[model samples]
Target: MTEMSVQLEQIAVRAARGVGDALRAAFVQAQQPSHKRDHHDLVTEHDERTEQVLRAELLDAWPDSAVLGEEGGASGDGAVHWLVDPIDGTANFALGLPFFAVSIGAVANDQLVAGVVYDVMRDTAFSANLHGAYADGEPLRSTGPATDAQNMLITSYPGPGTLAAGRGVEEYTTLLREFGAVRRMGSTALALAYVAAGAGCAYAYGIHPWDVAAGALIVQQAGGRYLPLPDTGRPWEAPGYLAVNGDFDLPGSCLTDLLPRMLPRTATGTPLPGGGLRNRP
Candidate 1:
């Protein structure tokens, strides 16, 4: 890893940790979440406040960088871009669930160089740089069962929009019948963090850049596979993704057969129309 990449990784980790206290205090408390695009999409004061905190920390650490946040839009214009998801899984967070996380990833000259996903409830940080990936400062390896039936898969597939699209239900059924077990924990960042930590594989559709930018880099750096479905110029910019452990057999897994049917294709690189719980983050 270059010295600059390592420095960026440290900055990302610290920036994510900076908001832990406020998030912990707000979690499970009575929060009046206002709708963003719809009832399924939610945002709270904490989300906005945390984004501000993260934006300040990141820009302060690297003054020549820009920030693209979920709550707040783009800020600054520099070679380095920071993708920030202040509070991933806001629904779970407001309801007292402990599956949310703070995710930040840095892109230098259009390439993802560093990322950090901090699990506030667990107090565990999953990070990665050009050098390698780490979990709580320890080296992380994305090793798991080799076969689909032997490994656990995490995904929030077949969300409201997907169902409305008329193909998600069948896809969801196939996953249930193929994988050993399937879980929907409502947090894409944490789900990908688990994949990086060797917990399992994760798949999702209809997500935004901030949703997978950090987790995707962490997973790949951990020696896992982070494949952006229907490449949209850049990996982090993809609308959907399928991440697996380092040892997963993608060609043999059912996912390979299902990808074409599940993800929408367009003549242009624009993302297909779909929506899900993870769409907010």
Candidate 2:
């Protein structure tokens, strides 16, 4: 990795850890979560606070950088673009479930250079840069069971949104029946982190850039496969993704059959125009 990429990785990790303590303290506290789009979508005071903290830390560390945060929207107008998901699994965090994370990914000139996914409950950080991927400072290797029948799969597919869109329910059902086991963890970042750590394969439909940007880089750097389904021109901007340990068999799995049906028709389905990267000023 170049020195600049390493520096970006360190910054991302530091920025994420800046608010870890507060999130830990608030994890179990009673929270009144307001709906974002519907009952299935939720946001809390902690989410907003955490995003604010992350935004301040990132911009302070690298003044010439922009942040695209899930809760706070876009800020700054610099060369490096940071995608932030302060509290990925708000419902899980609010309900006392220990399965959420702080995800931050840095894009320099349209290329993902660094990423960090901090698992607040476990106090473990998964990070990646141009150099490589690591979990708690240990190099990660995405090795796992080779077959769908032998591997575990984590996904939150066919949620209310997917069902409402009238897509992928039957395919998801087939996956549940075929895979060794399937789990819905709610946190997209953690799911990809786990895959990087050689835990299991993960697939998701209808995800945002903030949700998978960091995790996607981590997966690739760890020697795993992270594909934005339907091959949107920019991988991070895709509406859905399929990620797996390096050994998982994509062609043999049920996912191969489901891919065509899962992806949206257009190449730029979600329309993140001019959002890939920026020129350094």
Candidate 3:
């Protein structure tokens, strides 16, 4: 399993970087992206093309593997299942923001064994296998201040889906007050990667399997906490995620109040002391 995971990790890294040149070239030009769910959700030609490129590479590299990609959908039925989001921040990329990424993860035995989150613009890869997490091969650890007031929290919560569910500015405002600062950078994969690379808290609701699979593994491998919201047995089976810096000291944050209301299931686990919960699940 260890050797297989290492091989998969390498395959993910190579596949993610292989399409970089084309993506970078496309990034410079002004291109329009069609909307997916709404104006807030976008899908560009590059996104589709990149996913195709990644899918072909992954399947070719591991013939006995299946791929669940955001753009192209699922293919094959092997033991090692791959989750991929070719362009994680498509809206950001379309709008000329340098925050998108190529994310891929390998799941075997009902567990994440390998993963990679490639920051395309920066050409950086945060990878993890059974051994540990690394940023371009260096050991990486996700740690930050213990108190909310001492660190910066990054989130894209209250997205269109969340807003429709009644989690709007109030929850956002509350998190801002409790945390030293709150930022909405708009990329779940990269945001999770950032958290694993020693950034602050990151959470999201209404995410697909491809969106959080790789980043979740990266966070956990880098010594951070990647909690599937509502405590689903499998993180990808659920629609939400709550990721905290490795040394953030506690299990919950100011965002705790929003989770229960955001998802269909009630949140259950250890109680959150500092996390003010108005809508306790």
Candidate 4:
């Protein structure tokens, strides 16, 4: 890792640990919840507090790096940036479910170089940079393709109607039917981490930069592929995202074949592994 990447890694680790401590405190306190932008999307006191902790830690390490957080608005616009989801799966957390997480990703000049997705309930930290991805300190890699009978797909549920409301929903539904099994886990960061750890084969849905930033780095460093959502055409920010294991083949691979078949094909043509034609950062 470069010195910058190393320094960023330390920041991620510290933030993850701090956020985990915060979540534990919240769970113990049994805090009340509030709504954000809508009722289905929830937030908590801990979420805001955690973001404050992250903002301080992140900006201290990368003074010039832009920071865009779920709770707080964007700050700085340097070539390097920090994208954060202080509390992913807040609905689950508020309901006493255990799938919530804090996701943080670092992007340099539009390219993602590192990220960390910390599962507070489980205390499992998934992180990666240019060097490689690790899960709880052990080097991690993506799972190989499953046999036709074993394939599994994971999803996030804003609600039952959310998917059908989008043009991408039709494609998403078609894949849901084709896959051997489907699961709605309510947490995008954790869903991507499962893909990195080989617990699931692929994941696709609309997600914010904060939701996938850390998980994207984990997926890439784990030897997986992150195909950008075609609509936005940007890496650090996009309306939708897909992540799959690298061991899977391309062209006819589970992800490549499934994505275009479900969502409308991009006007620019299909999105490629690691976002083709679009330059990397």
lDDT of 2 by residue, 60-147 (tens): 8989899999998999999989999999999999888999999999988788889999999899999998999999878999999888
Q: Evaluate all candidate structures by whole-model CA lDDT and list the values in order.
A: 0.86, 0.85, 0.84, 0.74
Worst 10 residues of 3 by lDDT: 265-274
TM per candidate comes to 0.92, 0.91, 0.90, 0.84
* Model 2 TM-score, 2 decimals: 0.91
Show where candidate 3 strays beyond 4 Å: 161-167, 256-281
Candidates ranked by lDDT, best first?
A: 1, 2, 3, 4
| Model 1 per-residue lDDT tens digits across residues 1-281 | 36788999999999888789889988858989999999989999999999999999999999989999999999988888999999999998877788899999999877889999999999999999999999989999999888879988898877776677676788778889999999999999999999998776898878888999999999999999887765655889877888889998776788766766666544123443222212322
**Candidate 2 error regions (>4 Å):** 164-169, 264-281
Error (Å) of candidate 1 at residue 231 is 2.2
Q: Model 3, clash count?
A: 0
Residue pairs in candidate 2 whose N, alpha carbon or C atoms collide under 3 angstroms:
none
lDDT of 3 by residue, 198-246 (tens): 8888877678988888888889989998887645568765667778888
The residue ranges of model 1 lying beyond 4 angstroms of the native Cα positions read 265-281
User: How are the candidates ranked when ordered by TM-score, highest leading?
Assistant: 1, 2, 3, 4
lDDT of 1 at 116: 93
